[model samples]
Target: MSQEPDRLFAQPLAQVADFVFNEDVARVFPDMIKRSVPGYPTIVENISVLAARFAQPHTTLYDLGCSLGAVTQALRRHVRADGCRVIAVDNSAAMVERCSEYLHSQDSMFQELLPVEVIEADILALAFQPTSLVALNFTLQFIAIERRPELLARIRQALLPGGALILSEKLRFEDAIEDELLTALHLDFKRANGYSELEIAQKRSAIEKVMLPDSLQTHRQRLLDAGFSQVLPWFQCLNFASLIALP
Candidate 1:
């Protein structure tokens, strides 16, 4: 479904605070993400294809930090595993409320689709079931850096044999020159998407401290440390990339 255009950062703010998934963000999230993130639609759609491959019958699939149910709906649309159900979790009430509405719309429109349960809870606190598929799309960067390994280990422990995890995130390049060039290109992408110069600058200021990205090497090592047998990078657009991990 198409979303409204994002104009949240068009005007200059006297004081730009750290970004949060609040009510305003929930309203404009669809537009904000599409314009701000490169290759988002491709990532969201391919997640379902990956789900179809890895989803085991009667096992649960997870969409952690599911905003407005985009990935949840993708799973609902593509997964064919018998008795498989989706559990979508997020901490923001505003996002959950709107996401539930979207899912209800999806339910009425589709038939014989996998069922989904939306929970207004933190991902770190949930007691995970033995899962066949887990999608962590752009969610890990917001988590506390120190807590990331434990989170991945928990997911690994919860995963059934041959289970898969789809992890997508904005990456930080280790090389200073490459990082500078990519950052500029990403900003140019935002400009092309109708974000004003002030908007791009302000948004970056707001999120720089809150969203902490890791290098690809770091992510690979951590996944290995968490017991994943292999890490395969399936897609990369500018600074964003998605990886599939097998346990």
Candidate 2:
């Protein structure tokens, strides 16, 4: 994994374009995500713990939008189910190439890690196999809002009995006051993580156009409508949250 710092947004731009997960972003993703998202480490660690509890024998697990294979690595480290394998998918060719290298490195250091396949394909167009656990860690917000429900429905339909979907997302509050406070707090968090004002503002300009967030109520309702029997929120920090949707 590259240890380069995130400075993509440090310089001023005439027009901050919508963010894309290209080679430049892939190069600094580890540092960028760690500093930008609060409680990211904890969320990644716990995804494995949650996987161990729900992973069914002889079933496949999926890590959608698996940038650099962090969730896939965690699942391989902790999941001990018989005949289980992991399939990590990402749309960014750069991310997929780098992720494959990182997982290959993990293969050398670890013994008997679960078999994994990394593919570069748009997840919305990809076909899912029967899976026990599906992780969408901070990935759903990047999808077009109109297509999200259909995607979730497809995931729900592919899930085997006793399967689970772990979804982590940035949230938008319905209340004006709550939304303003949390948004301020998130900016403060970025400052505390060493991002300068220019970097923060530039990053925000780049992301706001592409990353569309929904309220918790909207998420729960959509999950239920997508055929999930129950939607359980398990973690929250400031304006971000993770949910477990069971079939």
Best by TM-score: 2
TM-score of each: 0.98, 0.99
State the lDDT of candidate 1 residue by residue for 108-149, as single tens digits. Answer: 999987899999998999899999999999999999999999
Worst 10 residues of 1 by lDDT: 1-10
Residue 71 error, candidate 1, Å: 0.5
Model 2 lDDT per residue over 108-190, tens place: 99998999999999999988999999999999999999999999999999999888999999999999999999999999999
User: Cα lDDT of all candidates, in order?
Assistant: 0.94, 0.96
For model 1, the superposed segments whose C-alpha errors exceed 4 Å read: none
In candidate 1, list every pair of residues with a backbone clash: none
